[model samples]
Target: MDFGPFLLLASLEGLVQAAVLSLTALGLCLTFGVMRVVNVSHGEFYMLGAVIAWWAASILGPKYALSGYLIALFLAPCIVGLLALASERFVLRSLNYEPEATIVATIGILYIIQQTVLMSFGPDAKPVNPPFYFRIDFPWFGYSGYKLFVIGAAIVVLSGTWYVLARTRVGLIMRATQLDRDMAQAFGIPIKRVYAYVFAAGAMYAALAAVLIVPIRQAHYLMGADPLLMSFIVVIIGGLGSVRGAIVAAVLIGMSDGIISMFFSPTLAKMVSTLLVALVLVFRPQGLFGVKTS
Candidate 1:
């Protein structure tokens, strides 16, 4: 009954899990806040990003592993974002003013993208090994450098996003559009353009998370589904359209999942997390940091 070591491991695992959730949810928050689209296939972008990393690493050889990672880190998001933009422009735009039709259209896009990926890459898992340096560990808690990197990277990216959103002009426009699309438009903001940019940005965020996580978890076509669900839950728990809420909720969920999965079974851990989300929905439907909408 060595709870000490188990607890330590669980905490680390939870943090990793939370980091992944935050990555995915950030995308959801961005798009949902601006475009009001759920983008169900968002998880597929992670799968695609990871696949891109794997393919690049394999095709380019060890000398190019770092290059491949770098490429995936940049290219994956751009590809997904562009795809989302095209979809929005051609498909979603046509379904304007019809929320239900638009949702269904996005779902169709998700399946099409998923199946197309499967056709191209098959259904097997593909690995993307981290660089050699990541194998080393720090003195404290035997935490691998790679895990630390993931945590640190998540913090830096999220922090940078926070700074930009809080300080930048585009960020202000995005916020304004999120709060009131019509008013923002009335003030000369191009509502359609905002929707396109935010959707692309959201997809890019999701892809970035995908590339980051691929080093830890092998890539597979279906890899994004669980993350997608978990992220939605994180977004729900944190309060919709609140970046601060997403961060807070991500850390909490990460810690909770890590600790619970360590002591109990993973299935039990999932059940507990879902139950927590349900409770939040029932009691504080607005979310921990979500502002109430009139």
Candidate 2:
């Protein structure tokens, strides 16, 4: 109603978006960071999560909405992760993980996944019921409880990822492999196995994000395109292969969409973000948090 309440509502919406975008972009960034392979099919993994969640919900029935969501929560990521692992072993590994070849193969994978979902599910947007429904009454507006849950869930996941990367032996191995694959192999690290796991983890992250957002946005065969483009924008603006950068950029871009779209239009919001990316490219090609490489 009022500007203050309107702004607050927009910010709240933006937080939900930021939370999901961080997970989506993080997956893409991590794939590039550790494996040095650009997985263009990353968004398709996200779509699969939503699609699978819809399937699980239909089977479980509306009487068991909560149970359906819970099943999808775990099932989507596991299936997506395994699929990613298979793709890595059979497709990427066969390509020798060459950057160019991997890109083309992943593009093909993207189209294949999109068309398959379109054929099987048809060209319709499928909605999944939220696990719980409640409203939080603010001074001037109401907020969805599930949206808050999305934000909290994302934070927990991000923190766990940070802990894994910063404090665990697995993280050490990953960092070592990322730093120098030949050297990591020389020290007896199974680089091939590590790559497989990293790729799977990346897909799992995308799937997790999709499961969270599906209730709010609904699932469609072509839905992956926007997230894929947004992830690329985030990756570019944040600097390629930078985890922290991707998260930070996702927040900035996600929030901007909310505020700007509220005051203006979604198209204008996108234009602003694109302009910001251009400015960043011109002034700081390495990005705000990215380290320069020789």
Candidate 3:
């Protein structure tokens, strides 16, 4: 294959990665942006989604693979979202939503979820088969049809998220709460309830991303670590609470990761990304889109 075709193929792969990363990071951004909580358990939610997807598929695939896969796609996020809401209500809310305390609480939640999965599902990595098999023939090679679907699905989901946050009453309420919790409360905005919903929504986004990508990548108990790290990187680089920045930064990081991993090494790709994040933090602590606070 020519270098140009090779590059194009790499870029396509990168776009898919960027799509998934954007969704994952957007979740983190939403939670932190609204609740001011650093959810250490966010990645575990991703893992749980994927694992649940695999479980759902396994149970249903024998008789109806396509239907089962579709059902898994729909159910995983809802289940994860509800679980997240419970955590927010019972754990974080009870803690008074303190940033440091919430972080510790989420870390504890992380281990709890991880160990529970380990005990129930064992340590094996499980694979969920794709619902359909087709490829788009490129000049140099064929690309996965399913991957293209993932890219398109992610775009739709992200767009819908934008619409809800930008154009809806609930979004306005969430924004109001984010801007000034005390003032919003004074207006009887039910800030705690908004926090619970935002927290759930964040986890739902993460779960949706996980479901979209789990077929390409097998479900594993330990899979949450990398997504968590990359989400943090994207959030930090894009600026905390900045949805636009997360999307832009996700593309940059995802493309770089794909191209570099294809041409060189995954380790090198990660090293470069980490270095870039460090530089961003050193020079722009508020992040690319983050407003400086007094």
Question: Residue 54 lDDT in model 3?
Answer: 92
Compose the digit string of candidate 3's lDDT tens values, residues 1-294: 889999998999899999999999999999999999999999999999999989998987667778878998899999999999999989999999899999999999999999999999889998889888898997679889999999999999989988998999998998999889999999999887899999999999899999999999999999999999999999999998888889898988888888888999898889888888889889998997788887
TM-score against native, each model: 0.94, 0.96, 0.97
> How much RMSD separates candidate 2 from the native structure?
1.3
lDDT of the structure predicted as candidate 1: 0.82
By TM-score, who's the top model here? Answer: 3
Runs of candidate 1 exceeding 4 Å displacement:
135-141
Lowest lDDT 10-residue stretch of candidate 3? 60-69
Residue-level lDDT for 130 in candidate 3? 86
In candidate 2, what are the lDDT values of residues 228-251, reduced to their tens digit? 878878987888888888999999
Query: Residue pairs in steric clash, candidate 1?
Result: 14-258
**What are the clashing pairs of model 2?**
none
Model 2: weakest 10-residue lDDT segment is: 269-278
